[model samples]
Target: MIDKSNQQSFQRLRLNLRQLEVFVATARGGSTRAAADRIARSQSAASTSLADLEAALGVELFDRIGRRLLLNESGRALLPKAQALIDQAADVQALFTDEYAAPLRVAASFTIGEYLLPSLVAQWTQLHPKSQIQLRIGNTSEVVAAVAGLDVDVGFIEGAQTHSDLVTRPWLADEMVIVAAPTHPLAGRLATAGQLADATWVLREHGSGTRQIADEWLLKHLGQVRVGFELGSTEAIKRVVAASDGLGCLSRHAVTQSVADGHLVELQTRLPKATRKLAIVLHREKRLGHATRDFLAHCSGVKQ
Candidate 1:
């Protein structure tokens, strides 16, 4: 255990608030000019602040390779610590500012963000109205990465991940159902693994968690299907499936309305159910704030 005096000494060695702020901004924005614009500081001032921070720490934070500013080894090593310090500082500021200070920053994948999280967030806000909530929606991989990198306090993702830096807890179960338009030739037919291999498939983009699961399942059962198109959004995939002869694998939640409205028909297949474990992920070393903790508890079905 670190002694309290040693902890204080280490804190003393940390960059001051202004320098830390500038460092974090530059690291996130990928350039001094972008950081300056974000923080309302001049570009020269941002650059000077970063230089002063590196000089004080005796390490170089960024390497100027061509036009881009990339984080060096030292920068990568210090980034999480710097971010933690900033989060702690924000907590300190919040402590003195009445009851609540700012919105909780959350990142979530497309399906969860679009189909599931609205009710949960609404309930959370009703209980803690003073606590604001900001959400960033992305694909599953992006959401997982955002939480692991401390870019957001928490993330809701659609599938299991093995990232060592993150602590993942099962939050929900999502089913991936294979579906096609009612007018498609395969609409009423039961598909065998061999039959599915011959049909054209509309797939999600590369980094989407749904896409990863779909691909893995396909590889395990059908080896490789004939892909007709790759789409980025779930809605777009649904539209393409409705208009084309291609079949699609999508979250059951995503196409519930379409299925009910007779636009799409779920195909019964010989393959096993493609159920995915949706997870709530957080940085392993980060402490959760009140609002963040509250949200997690709600998702976990634990009453505060």
Candidate 2:
């Protein structure tokens, strides 16, 4: 027991989830009425909640223009903190239920998301049957952007793509292969740089991690080459290359099944081997909850 007079006084917290939730919804929806609809509250109630939050913080979180509410610098600063607190509170509530945990939000680039994560996610779900995952698939640029923006809990990306706001951990090693139809002249033969350079290629789009690496590898030896088609999907590139005389550079994992099925043949070339490191990325400021941490541990096991 300490003396009552010596005890330090602390300020009582005026912030509440209701106010934060209202504020977040309003920020996302851009209007109080829109927030009301989103959170299933009356327009007046949403407006009141937003007003209370602003008053408690003693600063206007939003800038008013006509009927719209746009986040100012202060509001932008507070948004991620508010979202984290809400997720943590939900995690606490979920502990008492039969559910495994709060939903894990993940974004992944094309190769990992399509060829890799399905089996890993299925394995994770088997161990924790009630777990929920929301996975968004895009290219590495989008994955990096998603993690940097705090739009997802974590991201998996291919190649050396990175962001200053993200911490990248090398998660797996992957190889790239050049592929073409079996009937193509380069099939089953070691080709010179001139033969490779003269070939028309079908490759991924400009923003893709695969394209970045492919360009680095190809441009270094082959110089300028003709692009027959630029596609967004790895599968689309595989199919187009298999049907036409055009060649493709893609992940070995992405083209393995097609190569096995005789739909596409791996080309032997004199160019140096292409290999890349796939990485797990997270925002520097993100606070990992238990579910996210556990999932990361599960991912680490794959390298073993």
Candidate 3:
């Protein structure tokens, strides 16, 4: 004999997707604010959902010490089950609703994430009002890895290269430009090879598409430049470049506002137009489900 009493205790239990989502986010974030940001939910809503989950489970999923919430033993045990349920439920819902109910998991590199995907996601939401979009933003390599790891349904990357295991299709055209603070010396005139090579450059960290492109295009034109800093964030690089004499190479889209605001200046260069095609990639091993296919078709239509 088994313990029927334990099973009977949950006879009246009702657990919704929102609660599971909140729980999983809370666990992954280790803080309510990060979790709320991740899921795009209001802090109050996140907190309430977490509280509701704890109440329903009759156990505290997290231990509150000071303002921080740490997952306790019970939470550790429940996290995997909650994640599995969420993933399985999303798939099942897609099957039943012909993909309308399917949740979308999208990953994008920094340039696309900051400049493009938000608008695209807004447009996507307009068409499928009930669609749930979960987006992850990272560097190009990270986006490719996410696709390979099956962490995302689709990935957008601006790298000149992609993983062999992914199907790649060019999505958009992007131009990389060199930028500096308004007061920098090279901002107003064409930069000499020596000046370009001698200047301090704040560039993206290795494994980033922007950095790879710069390495391939800019570095060859101007001999090795002095690396002032290596940062993982494009926004941070922009801010740093705008605040100092350090020059940075970034997508033109990223520096548009800064240049217009007189905070950053787009530098003139003699090098061939450093343009690259932004690409959408899908894992070779995964067949496109209806939700994925629909999103792909939408991208194609929108681009066309």
Candidate 4:
């Protein structure tokens, strides 16, 4: 047990908020390079911060396994504490600032970010002109991590993937539709597994909620389909698929506009389950901020 009463022992500690922030980033990213990108730091600088943190605490936070950095027991235990510190710091930063002006930090997975959140946020902001919203978009894994780390007030994720630290509520239903360019061979007809296998499939990068569902559907039906390219954004994938012979699995919501604009064609393939529920995610222990709760309520089907 750490003794808070020991003034001499407390004086010897050299840890600071930056080191804690670095530790949390590394844990969330699972690698020094990814952590550096998340925190906007150089790889060497992030590594040095981690090293300093470990030395100050007299314990190794991450287990070095080949090129991957896995959080060891110590690292896992320290994560929540670090997250709490970061959240508290944000609270302190907002203390004297106008509450309405403080941005309602929202994290969302690609599908929701591209299709739904913008319009929803826009509508809400018209009602509360002073309210501000900042949307951070990432994959399911990243959004879950951000919510668990208290980096965002709320998150919306597609599919049934749930996190232990988040309270998930079924928000909306989304359909996964396979699409292609109007000029492609599979454009207006039913495509078989062999036909789809022959064409290039442009997919979202790994860890995306849409990608996770798409991978399962492809593995079961298309068996070892070739991915021509992996992209980070739903809009980017839709544009690429509209211009190339590549097939893309994306949210129906995401591709609806493109299909209507005569740029893309929806393929009729037998999918195991084309449907999944989008969930509202929030840290189990974190209280919802006023603006965030209002948006969340809107998503949950409340007329307000």
Candidate 5:
């Protein structure tokens, strides 16, 4: 049913999945050997496939710097397309196997990854038992970078962090609470601005989303406070605050259990309630695979 010109155009397709696979692996791993190791092929074969792909496309996709093969402008432009194609092909293969296809790569900030996602991920896995999900945990800034750099299919983060290359949607509402050990002087009474400003605090480190919000809230309410310990892990901050007389400001979800167990007490402060928005982030051009779309819908409580 095709015309001569259309038939000829169809016949001119020279790109193959194997070549694209090798190209993507090389771009991610930065070497032919690494790509070969990923795809279970010889180094020479990987190199040849990459070379053939470039020759067919009539452009160099990578710039060789010493021994590393970094993606050039052309390669960067083609990577998302190649990744999408590979994922779609896997989906096709999974059709006959009765399994979900394509590994879902997700990144999340501390609070969401620690307190929120575990239950959600468990529920998702119950529905899609054969699906594979990989999660990377970092602070909000790192989560934004991962999504923007195309290293993850989607990201969940806390706070109002935004990037030009990502689309962010508000996912959940969270509250920040100030806590202290049960025996701490301020634990049983309302904290005055002067007392809060004079107290020693154990807080999250500088770059974390919790720290950013805590800084803004505390500084607005009680000028400057003495930071006794700056820890990276929220659990560590909780433990340190419980053992010492210092206080911690953290997500309510993170501290509720401890407060209920009587290990930590929520401080009754005069400061206004501190609330933050947790968000979902994704690269602007990244195509969502079936599993990812389902997971997002599940998180959003959308019946899709």
Candidate 6:
């Protein structure tokens, strides 16, 4: 006869570390084959491990979507808890085994990620050699969502977010400048609001912070602005502006090198200066890691 307490412990042990590992890998990799490659296991082993995990949990974690596996609702619900458990386990191990903790995970929008953060990250990593720094770069909205959802420790975005779940602090000011190639007809002319409206405009994709500010500014002054093309990346937008007659609005940081090299010319406009508040955002309730806090201090000018 099995002892009652022993039975409960045995049942709990079924959802063991191996199961957690497989589940996490599958969730992240989105397929058994990919998870197997990530964990250095055979595809059959990964599939068996996932089957064991689902059986132990008594819940279907993923649904097959064509050839790929996607997290089902239960898997989606379990993801954060599983991640937190793993993070906590790593933290506990660090407490006992490691001399220093792991590096901070930080996310930021593309403009800052590409131009501003590399130097800052390098400087911070140099100052603390044992500390690791990981960065995730996305559009402004994606960064905000990541921070809000606790997918990233913190994020920097070039626009204001009104979400109540996030605490946003203004870190810096950024400006969007209208630009075109030197050969474009508007290159030398001081463009009036109406003339600016008449020109073909290449714009950033919808979710970009730069696009939001540009839209608001254009709507207010030009009554309505029509976009001739929508490109997903600043680099692509710059290329389009450089090779064509279309005008583009881009962060000053993004186009600085081009402007200096004279590949792109800033279009002087009668419109008011378009400024945006770059903000550091984090969840209101999350406790930030020491490395994250240190980086935030550096960004806020509270530290060197």
Candidate 1 residue runs with Cα over 4 Å from true position: 1-101, 302-304
Question: What's the residue-level lDDT of 91 in candidate 4?
Answer: 83
Report the C-alpha lDDT of model 2 over 21-105, residue by residue, as the tens digit.
9999999999999999999999999999999999989999999999889999999999999999988987788765854556889
TM-score of 5: 0.68
Q: Against the true structure, what is every candidate's RMSD? A: 14.3, 13.1, 14.2, 17.6, 13.3, 13.9
| Candidate 6 C-alpha lDDT tens digits along 128-234 | 67767779999889998998888889998987688889998878778989999999988899999888888889998888888888898888999868789998788
State how far residue 88 of model 6 sits from its true place (Å): 14
Candidate 3 per-residue lDDT, tens place, 35-118, comes to 899999998999999999889888999999887889999999999999999999887866557456667899999988888778
Query: Which model is ahead, 1 or 5, in terms of lDDT?
Result: 5
For residues 1-304, write the lDDT of model 1, one tens digit per residue: 8799989899888568789889889889999999999899999999999998999998888999876789999889988988899899888897548444467889999888887787788887777776677889999889988988899999998866788999888777778999999988777888888889999999898889989999988889998878889988888999999988899999887889889999899998889988988888989999987657767888677321
Question: Which is better, 1 or 3, measured by TM-score?
Answer: 3
lDDT of each: 0.86, 0.90, 0.87, 0.86, 0.90, 0.85
lDDT of 3 at 275: 89
- Give the Cα-based TM-score of candidate 4 against the true structure: 0.65
Inter-residue clash pairs, candidate 4: none
Give the C-alpha lDDT of model 3: 0.87
Please write out the lDDT profile of model 4 over residues 108-165, one tens digit for every residue. 8988887888888877788767777889998988989998999899888885556788
| lDDT of model number 4 | 0.86
Q: Indicate the residue-level lDDT of 155 in model 1.
A: 93
| Residue 174 error, candidate 1, Å | 1.4
